[model samples]
Structures are given as structure tokens and as C-alpha cells.
Target: MNLQSILSQHIIKAVSESYAATLENIEFQATRKDFEGDITVVVFSMLRTVKGNPVQIGETIGEYLVANVAEVSKYNVVKGFLNLVLSDAYYLDFFTSIQNFNSYGKVPATTEAIMVEYASPNTNKPLHLGHVRNVLLGYSVAEILKAAGKKVYKTQIINDRGIHICKSMLAWKRYGNEETPQTSGLKGDKLVGNYYVKFDKEYKKEINTLVENGFTEKDAKAKAPILLEAQKMLQKWEAGDPDVVALWKKMNGWVYEGFDATYENIGVDFDKNYYESDTYLLGKDFIQSGLEKGVFEKDADGSVWCDLTDEGLDRKIVLRSDGTAVYMTQDIGTAIQRVKDFPDINGMIYTVGNEQDYHFKVLFLILKKLGFSWAENLYHLSYGMVDLPSGKMKSREGTVVDADDLISDMAATAKEISEELGKIDDFSAEEKTQLYKTIGLGALKYYILKVDPKKRILFNPEESVDFQGNTGPFIQYTYARIQSILRKAASASGYTESVEIRNLTLEPKEKELLKILQQFPDVIQLAAGNYSPALVANYTYDLVKEFNSFYQNVPIFGAENPAEISFRISLCDAVGSVINTAFSLLGIQVPDKM
Candidate 1:
């Protein structure tokens, strides 16, 4: 057991024996820097059970702990805080107990499983900055859940149908003189995206012409030839017209190839993919069953609605009067389908933006009302929009920061900064290129993930690549430094192997490092419970900062004895291992050399 649990048990015993009162729990916090203790217990919280002045109670508890607990070497009372100084032997034992730091904090997989849905992008345009955030958050959360001992499946639902898709198909067929991604030297999604922009431009021109001929603005828009053709194309596609269906499959095929490239570039993948064309009509049967069960009502026009007024939400449409299923209907069916597909999964997390918060709230509520056992475990991982320092993005106008371009730009930025620093002067050309990509991607992922999901991000690429102060490069650099130290220690005579340090004296910096290291497993558990990668990101930054302080103030190879050198090197190795594991959880890579 950890020190906190051990201390809590003993402190509760002390409070009961001394004050003749039953204490239910113990409250503990990190010892203050000004104070000389390893951990601090808040005596103020114990007053409810132990009737005495806070300071007096703290002294009585401290006296009992020092006399009884072997770990508690000494103690001091500051106001109402009981600060316990643990023996050096306790920390030494902790260091020796860890068999392997590389897999140190992760728990073995449990029977429970979870499904995380992210990057459910539409087929109309290439993924942009907003999708980047969604993909990173979802991927990291899945990895964190796995580390926390849950079986996790990463998935996405591709929005591959509807008029938005037809717009691109119509534009590409009408405007291009038989241009293809191969012929045009453009990514398939970008090629399709270009046509999508073209359709909007042509549709606007038609609307303007009709308006000039004395038609109202609304009527002109409704009567635009390009939009009308696109709508007709959608109808034809829905009717399973051979020509239109073939065209959709061909165009959608191109876009899929483009999307795969981007997903690979960003280092994220889905275990399963659900297509709108396949799942869109799935909930129609469910709607009929719901109506028969009184879970839904039929309107005068024969439309189906779920009355949620009692639940503080307005009536939601499930099926149209014409028996056409709505997005809500499709979503309900898709959620149920996922459970059927993964029988062991007890929960799911949707990683969509905050704009759809209300939609998910209604979806989850309806599921619960339908009596699904897993509905209570559903969560909406709602996150704010990611804005660039310049401004917001609009996809139709083709002004959004393309994911492919942004990734390339990040690498370019890393190269520029690295050339200025001249740190990789000795690296070969191929080595330098790979290192640049690692550092660049690491900077991008860390900057976005280090913030709370609920908060909006104003991303700055140049700022993220900085090599100092809470940035990815700074932490990566520290990790690389530790690796270099390990290499040096391995080559030095008499310091190549582990040393038994049962009787070694502990330095202040070494104890501080140990204290921070001890919190890793607990931090992983906390991050998993909260569905927050920000917790893990910030914890890693704290660990890196403490390690840097230790590295500067304490000498490893120059220590007075080989045993001290061996111990310090071992600590360096542990810190490096953690940095790697932590970065991996965030979908970031650490470099052995920067």
C-alpha cells in the first residue's frame, strides 16, 4: 500500500486511542515547501470526531504516529497541520520495489470495457483544426482508459450521406474536364473539397442572377439551379439510382483514401468505422416499437415525436410524416448497434464539440427512458472549439486550417527552430527529418491537450514549439537529457550495474523526486475517472520540472561514491521511462536526441 493509505490507518487509530473518538477518514496534502515534512495531515478536519484544539490534536496524533509507525521517523505541528517526516529507508524501499519503470503506472486489463467515439467527420471536406482536437482528445482518452485497466475500443461514425456530399459530387461532375486526384496532383479529399467550394460559389452566382431579375432573395436561393440539381442528385442517390450510386462510391472512395493519409499522419486509428449510409435507417424499426410502447407519440401529420417536456426538453422528432428517419433516430439506432457489436462494453464516451451538448443530453435521456442498462454509463465528452490566433474557420469558403497542411507546417516550424538552435548539427539528413517530425507533432499534441477540454483554445504553432516553460519541447529535452546521462553512466567503469542502497543517506532533492514519482499511479487513476487528459499532461510537466531541478543541483557521475552514482542513474532512468509512457498516453512521441 501507498504511504497515504498506511498513514490514514495509523492516524485513525491514533485519534481513536487518544481522544476516545472514532475518525472515519484522514485528510492529507503535500507538505509545504517552507515546512520540513514529507506529507501533511490536516488536523482541522479531525475536530468533528476529536474534541480538542486543532494544534493540540495535531500534536497528539503526531506523537502517536512517530512512536508507533516505522515509516514516520519524526513530526512537527504547524498551526493545525501535522507534518510527518518519513524515514529515508521508506523512499529507498520504494525505489527498489519498482521492478520496471517503463510499465510502472499501468494496471493490468480488467474484464470491463469501454468504447470511445471520436473523429466522426463528414465526407464533404478535409479534416481541419477542430477535428485535430477531437481526434487527439478521443485517442488519448482511449489510451488512458486502457492504462487504467479498462478494455477500450476506439471508433468513429463517418457522416457519408446527405445533400452536403451531393454538393461536392455535383460540382465535380459539372466543373471539371475529367480531372482526378492522380491527374491534378491533389489529395482526394482536397480535390473533392475544392469542388464543394465550387458548388457554393456557382450556387451563389445563380441566386444573384435570379435576384437581379426581380426575385426575392429567399426565393432566389430556393430556386437556384445548382442547389436544385444537388437536391435532385440526393433524391436519386436515395432511390438507389445505379449511376448516382456508382458516382457516390467513386467520389467517396477518393475522400476515404485522403482521410486515411491524414489519420496516419496524425498517428490515430479507429478499431471500427460506422458509415451513415449503412446506419441511417436502422432506428426506423425502433421508432415503431417506441410508439407502441408509449415511449413516443404520433403527431397529426403522422410524424413520430418523443415528448421530453417533462424532462425539461422540448419534443424531439424521431421520424418524419413521410416515415423518413431523422438524425436523432439514426443516433439512437447507432448507439444500440454499438452495444450489440461489443457485448462486453458497459459504457461509451462521445468526443464531440460542446455545440452538440444538448443533443447528447437528449439522446442519453431517451435511451435511459427506453430502459437500456448501459444508458446510465453514457458520457458526452463535450469540448470547446479550437480557434487559431488569426480567427475562426469556415469550411464552405475553404478557409479552414487543413489538418494535412497544419501538420506539415508544424514540422516545418520545428525544422526552422531546430536549425536556429543548431542542436542536431551532427545528425544525418534522414535522422534530422524524422526527429523534426517527432518534435513537431509532440509540440502540437501537447499544447492542445494540456488545457482542460471544456476551455476554448487559441492555438499558436510557433508558441507551442518553444523549448522552455511548460512546452512539449522542454519536457522532451529533459527526457533526452536523462537518456544522455544514462548512456554516460553505462559506459563509466564501476557504475554500469545497479547498487544496493539500503543504508544510503537521502538528499533533499532526491526525496522530493521520490515524492513526485510516488503519485504517478494515483494520477493515472484520477485522470481516467475524470475523463481528462489535462490532468495527465500537467502531472507530467510537474515531473519533468522536478527532474530538471534534481539534475542541476545533484551530480550523478561525480557523486562521492559509486553507490550514489548508481542510485542517481537509476533515478534518471526511472524519470526517462515515465516521460516516455506519459507522452505516449497523450499521443505524443519523445526523442532520445533533440
Candidate 2:
């Protein structure tokens, strides 16, 4: 029932009646700024059905539309484009029709459900800048899907059991004099992460000592006492040694608490969590079944493989010769287990780095070959790495930008910028602190999300907190401005309700704002289909820019006509509501005052 659909129906009728030709569809685009029209129809596309010059065909259709459609007040044809000028009544009716702009664009949840996996981090180190991008992208996509009427479940798979985890446990037990997170006054993950780094340092020392005694570099590394002990610890843990298992549970418990704090700080949560210890061996049964069904092949060494050469991928190992499951095996089992847990989910999206693109491709192909219907709906939201202005991060060396530290730094940066701007001079201490966090986090989320997921990001904290240009603070400031206008309007009389306006003229800026506002629902649908938060982020920036232009050029309070002032106030309110809702989809908060 939108304008495009209405025009398309009428244009089809016009083509059949005038040219005696059947037009299957109509192509529409935004009217060029130079042209005085609301929407344009490409007559060039219609030439296949209507035999005539493009301009002539456009004119014929324009005439038919102006004559038949009430909304089409006037029209002009330039080259092959039929630009239709809609009546002011149409835009007015649109503005009046939306009762609540806050929830205006969101659709009610549908029966279709999807599981989005993100922030699946290893237990060895604290989450860093890369994980920040993953969580933000995943969280935003989930929100966008929900807005598009899909039931969504957010989840993560913790890498809790591995040789890397053993390294940390070995280091902590050997180096520390009974130090704990409580005693050390450090986060549990950071404490464990320190031991992980310590292990590497000690292991290198042992390797050097062995090399000095005439051993080869490779042999020295392989024979390092620290590494050998760590490997032995892994074997013991696998054998369910009581002592090692208890230590793992205790350390991992502390690490989980630390992880919960970080996740809370970053404003993301998982509906369900899958642990590697629990799911690592789950795919062995599936591998045996697959071998029996000819979906997989068993090598002479007793290893299981999935031959994907015909599908343009090499053979992938499902189980080792020792009958132990590989990472791929665990992932397959985890995916299947998710479906069993959430029966309504027909699809899943894995938000992982682009480095694992091939892995996901192989995983999806194998699942499809195994005859799982839902496997066809699987998607890999592969994103590029997030680098800092300094350089890339290495987790083992402990040089990665910690998520907690980055968040704190963002807030600190916001404070510096806000103090310099002196905008929140009247804010109380608590209010100022809260505002700083909002602006800082908003800036961080927006700067990263504004770019396409496939592109690498060189994040700059100071740059993101800027109050001008296409930054989060800039948009937040505009939203706050609209709120100020609304407050002023509320204090004045006769602007309480936005009633229908009759016998009134519309401003060009007002019409432009209406046009953009009308595209919100469609934009949400587009963003949802593409699984891209960049679309939603950029759309919000465009809306904010348009609103700012309208604010400067149009008179909201000083207008002579009461109806005009009321309508303008209503327009401002609608824009603010949308800004709030759009920011919500990006997991960014817009302040009422900044």
C-alpha cells in the first residue's frame, strides 16, 4: 500500500490501455534532486513491452498516472525518466498515519526463528578489539533481524578445553605463590592471561638453554621442559585426572565470571553457551554414521574425512586416526545440537572472522551433503580483522587492546571531548559520567559499524568521539537538539497533539524529511535481508543529516500559523523517535540531552 506499489499498479493499467501492451513490472528510483518530483519511473525498462520512444512512453504513462492516481498531482518527463510530483496531501497523510514513530518501522515477530552465533572466545585470554567488533556486529544483526520480524537467539561457544588452556594452568601452578584473582586485585581472565604469557617466556628460556647445549632449535623447542609439562597436563586433563579437572573447573569458573563482566560492560549477552569440553567429542557418533552412509570416508590409518574436492574444497578431517574429534567435528556437532535445542530455528548465522571463511563454507557444504534441510539456510557473516592505529595485536604476547580497557578509554575520550566542548556544564557529576559513557560507547559502536563488514578497520578512539561529521556524537547531538525543541514546544500552548492539517502549504525541507522517513520500514527489510548493520548505520546518519538541514532552514516555533507550528513540531518529534529506534537497532543509545 506504499506509493511505489500504488504507482506500479496504475502504470501497468496505463500501459495496457494506451499502448495495448502488457507490462510485467515497474522500475522506480529516487527522483533526482534537480528534478521537481517525488519519485521517478524508468521508461527505458518499459520499452520491451511498450513500443515507442522512451520519452514518449514516459509521457504517456505520466499522463495516465496524473489522470488516474489521486496522489499524482503533476508529472514531468526528462529523457526517459517519468518523474511524478505527488500531492502535499499524500505526504501529510503519511505523517498523520504514523501514530507512534518510536515503534513505527518495526514489524511484529514472525514464526521464523534464527540463531546468531558471536563472541565465541577462547578461555586463554581476555576479549580484545577483534572480539569487540564481532560482538557488535553480531548483536546489531540480531537486533535488525528482530526488527524485521524474525525470532532471534544469540549464542556463543566457549573454547574452554584445549592445549592453550593447559598452558595457562601449568604456568599459574608453577610460577604463582598461591595468587588468586581476589588476592591479586586483577580480573580472573587477566590473571590467567598473565600466566599464559609467563609460560611462553619460561618455555623460550628452556628452549634457549637446550640450544646452547648443542641441541637443534626445533629439537630444543620440542624438548622444552615447560612445553612438555603443559602437554602432559593436557593428557592428564583428557584422562579426567581428578586434580587437573578440579583446577580447570576452578580457573575456568573465575574466567567465566571475568567474561560475564566484560560482556555486561559491552552491552551484549548470549541466550545459550556451548562449552568445548562438553561438545568436543559429540561429533564422533555422527562421523561413524557418515562413514556408513558414504557421506564420509575412513582412511587406512582410521581417520575420518569428508571429500569436498568435487565441491572445490580439499578433503576435511572429521576425526583423527586416534578417533579424537577435530575442531570441524565439534563445530558440526554444535550446529546440530543447536537445532535440537531450539527446534523452531530454521536458519543460523555464524559471525566469525573472514579467516575462517573456507571453514564455514566446508562446514555448510558437508551439512547439506548430509541431507539436513536447515543446512541450506546457513550463513557465514565473515568480517575482516579490526586493527588499531598502532598495529595488529598478538594475544600470546599480551599486547592486544583489552575490551575492558578499550571501553574505559572510550569513556575517557568522551569525557575529554565533552569537557573541551563544555556542552554539559550544567550536568550533575553522576549525569556527566553517564553521558560520557553513552557518547563514548555510541561513538565506538558507530564508527566501527558504519563501514562494511568485509573491510578492515583501523580504529581510532579519539576520532570516533568527535562531535561533528558522521560520528555517533554528532548524531546524538542532533537527537538531543530535537528533544530540546520538543521540550520547548511542550511548554508552549496549542502544540500538544499533531492533528491533520488542511488548506496548508508544505515546505520543501518538510517534504524531503517525509520522503526519508517513509523509507524506514523498507530500509529495515533491506538491512535484514542482507544481514548488514552498515546499511542501518548509514541510513541513520543520512536521516540525522536531513533533520539537521530541516532544523536550520525551517521555522518551528516562530511560524505565524498555529497549524504549521504544530505540524513542524510533530515532524521534529517523529524524526527524534526514529533516531532513537534506529540507534537501538545498532545497540547505540541516543541521549535526550548532551
Candidate 3:
């Protein structure tokens, strides 16, 4: 068991014997820096049961703990705070026990599974800066959950069929003389996205022309020839028109190829993908079931809706009056279908923007009202919008920050800054190029993932790529420095992976580093519980800071004895291993020689 668990157990025993108090919960916090202790037990919380002077109660408990616990060498009481000073042998024993730091914090997988859905992008446009946040958050949370011993399935639902999709298709057909992604020398998604923008431009012009000719703006918008044709195309596609279906297949195929490239570049992958074309019609049957069960109400016009008035939400439409499924219907069907596909999956997390927060709330409630056992496990990982330093992005007007372009720009920025700093002097051309991308993408992912998901981000690419402070490059550089130290130590001693030194003394900085390392498993569990990657990201930064302090104040290679040098080298290896593992969880890469 961990030291904290051991301490808690002994402390409870002491309270029961000395104070005769049957306490169920014990609150522990970091020892105040002003106090000479490692962990502080809050004596204030025990006053209800023990009914005595808090200081005296603390002193009695501390005396009992120091007398009984091997790790607890001594203790002190500051008011109601019972501060316990643990022995150095305890830390050394703990460090020696964790032999494989690479997988130290991870737990064995359980039978129950979780499904995390992220990066559900539309085929109409390429991914943007906003999609970056969604994917990073989802991917990191999935990793955190897996580390916490839960089986996880990563997935996405592609928005490949809709009126917006038809707009792009119609535009490509009207404007192009048989141009393809290969012919245009552009990615399929980007080529299709250009047409989507083109359709909006032409549609606006048509609307203005009709309005000038004495039509209302609404009428003009509805009556625009291009939009009407796009609507007709959607109807035809829905009706399984042969030519329209073929065009859609061909265009969507291009988009899938393009999207695959982007997802690969972003270092995220899905185990399965659900398509709108296949799943859009799924929830109709569920709607009928809900209506039969009185979970939903059927209006006089034949529309199906769930009345959420008592739940503080307005009525939500599941099916239209024309017997067509809405997004809500499709979502409900898709969720049920997933359960059918993966019987072991007990929960699902939908990584989506905060704009649809109400949508998810209503969806989850309706599912619960319909009496699905797993409905209670549904969570919407709602995140705020991402804005660039320049301004907000609009995809239709082509002012959006394309994911591919942003990634490339970040790499180029890394190259510029690295060359200016002269940090890659000993690297070959190929190594330099790879390191640049690693550092660049690392910076981007870290800058975004470190912030709380609900907070709006004003992304500054330049600021993010800096090789100092709490950035990804900073942590990566520390890992590289450790790597360099390990290489030198290995060469000097022909070092093996053994830490046999049992009697070596540790400095204050070394003990501080060990203390932070001890918190890794707890941090992983906490991050998973909160479904927050920010917690993991910031924890990693703190670990790096602690390691840096140790590196600065202690001597690793030039230790007083061979045992001390070996122990310090072992500590360095463990820190590097953890840094690599943590970065891997965030989907960021750390270079060995950055």
C-alpha cells in the first residue's frame, strides 16, 4: 500500500485506541512549508467525535502514530494540524519499489469499458483550431481513463450527409469543369471545402439580386436557384437517386481520405466510425417506442417530442411532423446502437462544444425517462470555443484556421526559433526536421490541453512554441537533458538497471522530487475522475519544475560515492520515463535529444 494509505490506517487505529473516537473519514493536506512535516492530518475534522482541545487531541494522535508507524519517525502539532515527519528510509523504500516508472501509474484493465467520442467533423469543411481542442481533450481523457484501469473505446460520428454537404456538392458540380482532388492538386476535404465557400458566395449574390428586384430577404433566401437546387439534390440523395448517390460517394470518399490524413497528422485515431448516412434513420423506431411508452408526446401535426417542462427544459423534437428523424433522433439511435455493438461499455463521453450543452442535457434526460440503465452514465464533455489571436474563425467565408495549415505553420515556427537559438547544432538534417515537428506539435497540444476545457482559449501559436516556462517544449527539453545525463552516466559506469544502494542519504531537493513522484498514480486517478486533461497537464508541469530544482541543487554524476551516483542516476531515469509517459498520454512527443 502507499504511504498515505498506511498512515491513514494507523491514524484511525490510534484515534480509536487513544481518543476512543470512531472516525470514518480522515482529511489530509500538504504540510505547511512553515511546519516541519511531510503530511498534515486535519485535527479540526475530529472535534465532533472527540470533544476536547484540538491541540491536545492532535498531540495524542501524533504521539500514538510516531510510536506505532515505522515510516512516521516524529510528529508536531500546530493548532489543529497534526504534522507527521516521515523517515528517509520510507521514501527510499518507495522509490526502490517502483522499478518500472514507464508503466508505474497505470493500472490493470477492468472488464467494464468506456466509449469516448471526439472530432466528429463535417465533410463540408476541413478541421479547424476548434477541432484541435476537442480531439486533444478527448484523446487525453481516454488515456487517463485507461490509466485508471478502465477499458476505453475511442470513436467518432462523421457528419457526412446533410444539406450543408449538398451545398458543397452542388457548388462543385456547377462551377467545375470536372475537377477532382488529384486534378486540383489539393486535399479532398480542402477541395470540397472551397466549393462549400463558393456556394455561400453565389447564394448570397442570388439573394441580393432577388431582394433588389422587390423580394423580401427571407423570400429571396428561400427562392435562390442555387439553394433550391441544393435542396433538390438533398431530396434526391435521400430518395436514392443513382447519379446523386454516385457523386456523393465519390466526393465523400475524397473527404474521408483528406480527413484521415489530418487525423493521422494530429496523432489521434478511432477504433470505429459511425456515419450519418447509415445512422440518421436509426432513432425513428425508438421515437415510436417512446411515444407508445408515453415517454414522448405526439402532437396533432404528428411530430414526436419529449416534454421536459418539469425538468427546466422546453420540449425537444425527436421526429418531425413529416415522419423524418431529427438530429436528436439520430443521436438517440446511435447511442443505443453503440450499446448493442459493445455490451461491456457502461458509459460514454461525448466531446462536443458548449453550444450544444442543452442538446446533450435534453438527450440524456429523454434517454433516462425512456428507462435505459446506461443513460445515467452519459456525459457531455462540453468545452468553450477557441479563438485565434487575430479573431474568431468562420469556415464559410474561408477565414478559419485550417488544422493542416496551423500544424505546418507551427513546425515552421519551431524551425525558425530553433535555428535562432542554435540548439540543433549536432543534429543531422533529418533529425532536425523530425525534432522540429515533435517540438512544434508538442507546444501546440500542451498550450491548448493545459487550460481548463470550459475556458475559452485565445490561442497564440508564437507564445505556445516558446521553449521556456510551462510549455511542452520546456518539459521535453528537460527529458532530453536527463537523457544526456543518463548517456554520460551509462558510459562512465557501464550502468545496469539496478538500484542496490540501500543506505545512501538523500538531499532535501531529492526528497522533494521523490514526494512529487509518489503523487503520480493519485494524480492519474484524479484526472480520470474529473475527466479533465488540464489536471494531468499541469501536474506534468509541476513534476518537471520539481525535477529541475533537484537537477540544479544536487549532483548526479559527481556524487560523493558510487552509491549516491547510482541512486541519483536511477532517479533521473525514473523522471525521464515519467515525462515520456505523461507526454504520450497527452498525444505529444518528447525528443530524446531536443
Candidate 4:
């Protein structure tokens, strides 16, 4: 058991023996910074059961703990808080017992399985800054879940079929003379995205011309010839027109290649990919069943709707009057298909933007109403949009910051700052390039993951890559520093394994570092439970801060004794291992030589 569990058991015994009163539970908090204690027990909570002055009660518990608990070296009663200082031997014993620091806080895989769907990008455009956040959040959460012992399958649904796609195809056909990714030297997605913008521009011009001719703006927008043609293209594609299908497949192939390069650049991958084209028709049969069972109602227009009004949500359409499936139907079908694909997956996490928060709520409720036991385990990892300092992005106007561009800019920024620092003089050109990529992507991932997923971020590349404060480069530099120390220690003593630390009084700084290191496993579990990488990110920052304080205040290689030096070096090794493990969970890489 951990320190807290041991202390709680002893505290319960102390309270029972001292006051002859049984306690049901104990409340604890981190010791205040000004207080000389490792953990604080709240004495005021006992007042609800055993009536007495709070101070007297606190003193009684503190005295009882010091007398009864072996780890409790001393205690002080500060008001109703009983601050208990743990013995240095306790921390030293805990540190010495840890044999493998590399895999220290990770858990073995459990039977329970979860599917995390992220980076569900549309095939029409290259990934943008918004997708950057989604992929990073989703990937990190999946890693965190794995660390917490769940069998996780990473996947995404490719949004390959829709009217938006038809717009791009039509734009390409009307404007281009058989241009392709190879001939244009543009990524398939970017080329298609350019056409999408072109279609919007032309469609708007048509709308304006019709309005000038006395047509209502709404009617003009709907009646625009380009819009009508795009709709017809969609219909033809749906009807399996061979030529239309061929064009759709060709364009989607290019987009998929573009998306693959982007995902690879960002260091995120998936175990499976679902296509909208295949899944869109999946829920029609389910909708019929829901209608027959009165779980859904058919409107007068012969459209199918799920009446969620009793559940406090508005009615959601499942199928159009023309018998075409809606997005909702497609999603329901996708969920069922996934369960069929992975029978062991008991839960799913949809890592999407917060705008579809209600959509997920209704989806989950409908699944539960459909009598799926796993629906209760479904979660929507809703997150806010990422805004640059410039402002919001509009995808259609080509104003969104492309994911590929942002990643490239981050590397360039890292290269500039690292070159200015002049810290890698011994590195070759290729090594330098690799290190720059590591630092750049690490900064990007860390900066985004460090924030709570629900909060919008105003990302600044310069700030994230800085080597000071709560940034990725700062933590990475510290890890490099520890590696340097280890290399020296190995050269000096010819020993790299952990040494047994016995009968030595650890310095305050050493004990503090060990205390923080011990909390890593708990932090991972907490992060996984909340599906928040921010918790893991911030915890790592705190650990780094603690290690820095220890490094500055204590001596390792220059220590007077061999045992002390070995113990300190071991501590440094442990810290570096943790830094690497934590960064891995965030999908960030750490460099050995910085």
C-alpha cells in the first residue's frame, strides 16, 4: 500500500484508542507549504462524530500518530490540521525498493477494453490547427488509458462522402484540364481543398448575380446552378454512377495520402479506419426497428425522427423524406459496426470538438434506449477550439492554419532558438535536424496537451519552444541534464545499476524528489479516469521543478561519500526515466543530448 493508505489505517486506530470512538472515514490533504509535514489529516472532520474542541482533538490525534505510527517521526497541530512529518527512512526505503524506473508507473494490460476514435478528418481538406488539437488530445488520452491498464484500440472514421466532397469534385472538373497531385505538385487534399474554395467563390458570385436580378438571397443561394450541380453530383455518386464513383475514389485516394503524411508528421497513428461511404447506410434498419418500437417517430413528411424531448433534447432526424440517411444515422451505424469489429470493446471515447456535445449526448441516450449495455460506458471527449493570436479560422475561405504548415513552422522555430543557444556544437547535420524535429514536435504537443482539453488555447510557437518556465523544451532540457550527470557518474564509478541505500539520512531535497516521484502512478490513474492529459502534463512539470530544486541544493558527483553519490545518481536516473515515460504518454519525444 502507499503512504496515505498506511497513514489512514494508523490514524483510524489512533482515533479509536484515544477517544474510544469509531470513525467511518478519514480526510486528508497535501501539507501546506509553510508547514513542516509530508501529509495533513483534517481533525475538524472528526467533530461530526466525536464532539470536542477542534484543537484538542487535533493534538490528541497528532500525539497518537507519533506514538503509534513507525513512519510518523513528528507532528504539529496547526488549528484543526494535524500535520505529520514522515521519517526519511520511509522515503529512502520506498526509493530503494523501486528496481525498474523505466517501466515504473505503468500498469499491465487489463481485460477491459476501450476504443478511442480521433482525427476523424474529412477527405476534402488537409488537416488544420483544429485537427492538430484533436489528434494530439485523442492520441495522448489513448496512451494515458493504456498506461492505466486498459486495452485500447486507436481508430478514426474517415469522413469521405458528403455534399462538401461533391463540391470539390465539381470544382476540379469544371476548372481544371485533368490536373492531378503529380502534375500540380500539390498534395491531393490541398488540391481538392483549393477546388472547394473555388466552388464557394463561384457559388457566391452566382448567388449575388441572381439577387441582383430580383431573386431572394436565400432562394438564390439554393437555386445557384453550381449548388444544384453539386447536389446532382452527390446523387449520382450515391447511385453508383461508374464515372462519378471513379472520380470520387481518385480524389479520396489523394486526400488519404495527404492525411497519412500529416498524421505521420504529427506522430499519431490508428489501428483501424472506418469510411463514411461504407457506414452511412448502416442505421436504416435500426431506425426501422426504433420506429416500430415507438422509440422513434416518422414525421408527416415521411422522415424518421428520434423524439428526445422527454430526455430534454430536441427531436433529431435519422432519415430524410427521400429515404437518404442523415449524419445521425451514419454515426449510429458506425458505432454498431465498431462493436461488431471489436467484440471485446466495452466502451468508446469520441474525441471531437465541443460543438457536437449535444449530438454525443443524444447518441449515447439513444444507444441506451436501444438496450445496449455498453452505452453507459460511452464518453465524449469534448474540447474547445484552438485559436491563434490572429483570430478564428474559416476552412472554406482557406484561412485555417494548415496542420502541416504549423508543424513545419514549429520545427523552424525550434531550429532558430536552438542555433541561437549554440548548445549542440558537436552534433552532425542529420542529428541536428532530428533533434530539432523532436524539440519542435515536443513543444507543439506539450503546449497543447498541457491545457485542459475543454479550454480553448491561444497557441504561440515561440512561447511553447522556450527553454524556461512550464514548457516542453524546459522539461526536455532537464532530462538531458540528468542524462549528462548519469554519463559522468558511469565514467567515474563504472557502476550504472541502482545501489542499496542503507542507514543514510536523506537530505530534505532528496526526500522531496522521492515523494514527488512516488506520485507518478497515482497521477496516471487520475489522468486516465478523467481522460485528461493536462493532469499528466502538469504533474510532469512539477516533478521537473522538484528535480531542479534538488539538483541545485544537493551535491551528487562531489558528494563526500560513495553511497551518497551513488544514491543521488540513482535518483537522477529515476527522474530521467520518468520524464521520458511521461513525455511518451503525451506523444512527445525526448532527446538524450538536447
lDDT, candidate 4, 1-594, per-residue tens: 877787788878877887788888889998878999999999889888877887888888888888888899998998899899989888888887787999999999999999999878888888898999999999999999999999999999998998999999999999978999999999888999999999999999999999999999999999999999999999999899999999999999999999999999999999999888889899888988888888889989999988888878898998999998888888888898899999999989999999999989999998888878888999999999987666788888777888898888888888998899898989999999999889888888888899999998886544444546898988998999999998887688545464557678888888889889989999999999999999999999999999999898888888877778888888999999999999999999998887
User: What is the descending TM-score order?
Assistant: 1, 4, 2, 3
In model 2, residue pairs whose N, Cα or C atoms come closer than 3 Å (at least 3 residues apart or on different chains), thus clashing, are none
Ten consecutive residues with minimal summed lDDT in candidate 1?
A: 459-468
> Could you give candidate 2's per-residue lDDT for residues 1-594 as a string of tens digits?
778899999999888988899998899999989998999999999888789999988888899999999999999999999999999999888888898888999999999999999878989888898999999999999999999999999999899999899999999898888789999998999898898899999999999999999999999999998899999999999999999999999889889989999998888888999898999888777887888889999899999899989977899999999988888998889889999999999989999999999999999998888889999999999999987677888887766888899888889988988899898899999999999889888988898888899899887644544556998989999999999999999898878584658556888988999999999998999999998999988999999999999999888898778898998998899999999999999999989898
Q: List model 3 lDDT by residue over 36-99, tens digit each.
A: 9899999999888877899998998899888889889899999999999888898999999896
User: How far is 491's C-alpha from truth in model 2 (Å)?
Assistant: 2.0
**Residue pairs with clashing backbones, model 1:** none
Each prediction's TM-score against the native?
Answer: 0.98, 0.97, 0.96, 0.97
Those runs of model 2 whose alpha carbons end farther than 4 Å from true positions after fitting are: 460-465
RMSD of 3: 1.7
lDDT of 4: 0.89
* C-alpha lDDT of all candidate models, in order: 0.91, 0.90, 0.90, 0.89
Show where candidate 4 strays beyond 4 Å: 460-467, 494-498
Clashes of each: 0, 0, 0, 0
